[model samples]
Target: MSIWKELYDIFDKERSRWQQSSASKQAIAFELKANLGFLADALSSGLSQSAIASGLECSIFEAKLKEGAALTALNRRKVTLTFIGEFSEFAKYVGKENDALVENAYSKIKSLQKLVAAEPNKSHDLRIKSLFRFLVFLVAHLEEQPLSRTSAKKAEG
Candidate 1:
């Protein structure tokens, strides 16, 4: 199956899971975070720097619109996905010690769902770009972790 189809399927399943129960929401958030992390690693390893840089430039251009109106009209789905990416990083940092962090991640994921649902007219390309941005943010967070502290914590654990 195409990547777009796969992503759509995952989104559908996650949305359904989100509606089932509180536990399901947690599960969906965890699954999405793991999937995005894996995608980030795969993209980082598979794609050339130039290709990634070009994509980043385009996203930056869209983000930097000087006109306040244009900026306000930015895709809500993308904004929500970015928030999900951020919450994922926070959850990773807090680990299992903080239920609130995980809950916040789930909440952001739900917000993304709502945005997508409300904006059914959004293009597939927009959704894919949002997902890519999320993965990039996640990868950056993973790479930002201090190795010394991480190792020390692991040893303590």
Candidate 2:
């Protein structure tokens, strides 16, 4: 399937999982569209692979707060997939972009950390959850073959 189709599929799947009212779903969809736009813009900027990963991970945290306006658009509550499942998907994306994704993720995370530290107390739970979600997303997007499987094989020796 085309990338846009894949993204739409992901969005549809996630949207169906939500039990919220129609109004709420509409709001969520609106936010998601905005978020996707931001993601696209970021992708166009020629960010390093690490940068994309970093942005993906870091944006999760920002999605929760007003300060993370850039990322808040990406929020999709009632995410259907488990954290691990989300991570697995992200790992696939990371596999495609490797070094660039990692660098992107790292840089984005640093910026996110700064924002989180600035707020400290407000929306703490959401902030923490966002961070965890980002980590899961990163793990999912990263290449699966080389890192864990190879390491495990070596360890079994």
Candidate 3:
């Protein structure tokens, strides 16, 4: 199977699992993590294609995909950061009382951004590695949060 197809399947599975489970804050976080994973894979795959095209001296399609992937990655990163910010505000409003968690998430996001900046003209492999690291940190943060009442009910059911 193509890497893109595999990534889509993974994303679908994660989304399905999240929907079947209780839609808790942590569950939402997991969903976001899945999304980030999908984007990372897509971006990496596109970069690989670009590299292949360059090596093979192929047509323009690969270049287009490469450009599109970069734009997609940038947009996704922005959206992810925005979502985290909004989630943090919501946590505060609901009295979830976890400033540290929000701070940690922000820290990871900034770290990922810095990594991208450090290698503006580097290989996509490096970016993919950084993305995986970010995902790991994100998952750890999500795991630390308390499960919602709905999640508990779903688990019991």
Candidate 4:
């Protein structure tokens, strides 16, 4: 079977499982987090720099516009897949640029991936708020700055 088909089948099962019961809801939540963690790793490992940069753009937009309040585990599957589709398509148009911003964004996503595993007792709402703040900074900072990030700057003497 094709990768797309396989991914759809798996997510379909998860979505079906989502509707089954309250207990299953918790399982789906963890699954979404784990998926994001795996996604970060997979995207980091294999994709071209331009593609990853595109993904980062999509990630930042999704996080900021939705304001985290709208992004819950229930909708995470859709969000994740949409990101993959968008970035891959967007990559075909953009050129190699913003390597530093791409790397920085990748690091941030890695950090976000780790947050899910870090605090088991924390409420998802709190985690969402924290992630929202983190993403908000990216949108704010990136917009104000130019994309000429060739290298990380050293402290000025």
Candidate 5:
């Protein structure tokens, strides 16, 4: 019933429909592999999590996802790296595990970069969409996780 699970089923259906849909399957699988720790850390360190989760700035995140999906292979590379750099720097001052947070952010972005880099433009768009869907789900799911919920409670209490 969770959104993440539904999105996951859609991913499976896509892979089945496309047969050897390597790019999409691979991208979606990699994101699904992300541990809860990494997801919590990424939400804490990512620039737009709070805004998107709060429904105040979903537009920017949506625009980025849409634009990245439309970008050519080379431009996707540029956009991915730009995001990596921004997330890396943003993670530095986010909290206690500064180094590890940067590493986590770097790892996530680099994996997406690799996915985007390996596929042609036509297939790359699907790769971007798969990753974007995972991210959107993350933003929403954080609200239901102890990670964000506990923190919010602490701040309130």
Candidate 6:
């Protein structure tokens, strides 16, 4: 089966299990997957109102999932975001929307400018932090569609 198909299967199974479980945690997981799947389908079909609604639902579901995940992940080793580079690539890749990201970057740069003016010595850290924040925003934006298999191969290279 295609990777997307496999993922859909996995998500479907997990959602089913979650829905059946007595645990609120499982219910939350089910909701998260449902929203994610809806978002994926919507984006694939070209960002219709349904897709936007799904994305918004996913955002809400994520809040709950995050709380659960955080409790578990807190005990695990933390992976730094530095390896991923900037979130702009993610924004470009997933949401395929760049205008808002461009505006965000512009705003961030302006804020950094003010900071730099006040304390030139901290510019290095400020730049790094700004880059990290922008990248994270972009990454979250991109989590919607993902890349095509052929494009993924090119990206890996």
User: Candidate 4, residues 1-157: lDDT per residue as tens digits?
Assistant: 9999999999999987655433433343343344344445544476443333233223442343244222232222211222223234233313322233333344655554455456544444433333333333233232332212132133112
Residue 122, candidate 5: C-alpha displacement in angstroms: 5.5
* lDDT tens digits by residue: candidate 3, 25-111: 333354446645564555656645233222221122234334332212111221233233434423332322223333344444444
lDDT of each: 0.41, 0.42, 0.43, 0.38, 0.37, 0.42
Q: lDDT per residue, candidate 1, 1-157, as tens digits?
A: 9999999999999987545444433333345456455435546577442333232222222222222212212111222333334344333433322233323333444444455556645543444445555444433333343223345458559
Assess candidate 1 and give its TM-score to the true structure: 0.27
Report the CA-based lDDT of candidate 3 relative to the real structure: 0.43
On residues 1-157, what C-alpha lDDT tens digit does candidate 6 reach at each position? 8999999999999998655433543443344345445444544566543224323333323454454432221112222233233434443333323333433443454454465556555424535344444543433333423324454469459
Worst ten in a row by lDDT for model 4: 147-156
Model 3, stretches more than 4 Å misplaced?
1-31, 43-102, 114-119, 140-157
Clashes of 1: 0
Error of 5 at 90 (Å): 28
Weakest lDDT window of 10 consecutive positions for candidate 5: 70-79
Candidate closer to the true structure by TM-score (higher is better), 2 or 3: 3
- Candidate 6 regions off by >4 Å? 1-25, 54-77, 82-157
Arranged by lDDT with the best first, the candidates are 3, 6, 2, 1, 4, 5
The TM-scores, one per candidate, come to 0.27, 0.28, 0.29, 0.22, 0.23, 0.28
Candidate 5, residue 87: how far the Cα is off, in Å: 28
> Which one wins by TM-score: 3 or 5?
3
Model 2 Cα RMSD, 1 decimal? 15.5
**Candidate 6 clashing pairs?**
87-135
**In terms of TM-score, how similar is model 6 to the real structure?**
0.28
lDDT-wise, the better of 2 and 4 is 2
